[model samples]
Target: MKTIALLVVLTVVAADIEFYKTANDNYDIKALIANATELQAFLDCFQDRAPCSELTASYKKNIPEAVVQACKKCNPSQKHMFRQFLEGVKKVVPKEYNEFRQKFDPENKYFDALEKELSKF
Candidate 1:
């Protein structure tokens, strides 16, 4: 019971921090999945075997841990499909947006951080 409560408190605090940091919609789980969809597609394009073909399909069938974390941070209704166009623009955008090109994705910061933090759980 105590462990569960601690987890909850940690989650709330994390959410608050994200909200304060982003000052934008805290991406929900589905949105995280959407982001994964984008990632899968990109990977598929780069790899000779086409990672997107497998990655996107896998996400549609089974949600990833990153997606679940995103869902926890934001509301369910906020979920949206990931767009390749937005991702493309991110490449040319200023470094501030890229945050040292962390993960080579600007919008993925939340999902990335969530995945890292949740790994311990």
Candidate 2:
């Protein structure tokens, strides 16, 4: 009976686990950042100034939850990649970075907390 109860608890715990999609994890963020056109596409997509590809759309859809939750669902690699991406964007394209902040964090409620969380990884 104890063994059965343990199995049930383990199953429940496993079922509760959640994570963000990893399909785009392997994309070369550094290359994307270095390319002006590709970077602008991402910016336009996020800002709704242009249509988004399926991949970018997925990210755009999740940005709010990811920010508010401090990327709790993100895996370690994602955390590192995101940190790099954010830093790169801030440094390489300050104007677009601000636009992204305005779009995603309009009231300025979450960027600082998000930055704090990202810095952890």
Name the candidate that leads on lDDT: 2
Each prediction's total of clashing residue pairs, residues at least 3 apart in sequence or on different chains, is 6, 0
lDDT of 2 at 19: 73
1-116: candidate 2 lDDT, tens digit per residue: 99999999999986786878855876788898999899889889988999999888867787878887888787777777778778889999998889888888889998888888
lDDT of 1 by residue, 29-99 (tens): 33433565554444444332353454344333222323445535333222322222224334433442244
TM-score of each: 0.23, 0.81
Candidate 2 regions exceeding 4 Å error are: 1-15
Best by TM-score: 2
What C-alpha lDDT does candidate 1 achieve relative to the native structure? 0.40
Model 2 Cα shift for residue 79 (angstroms): 1.7
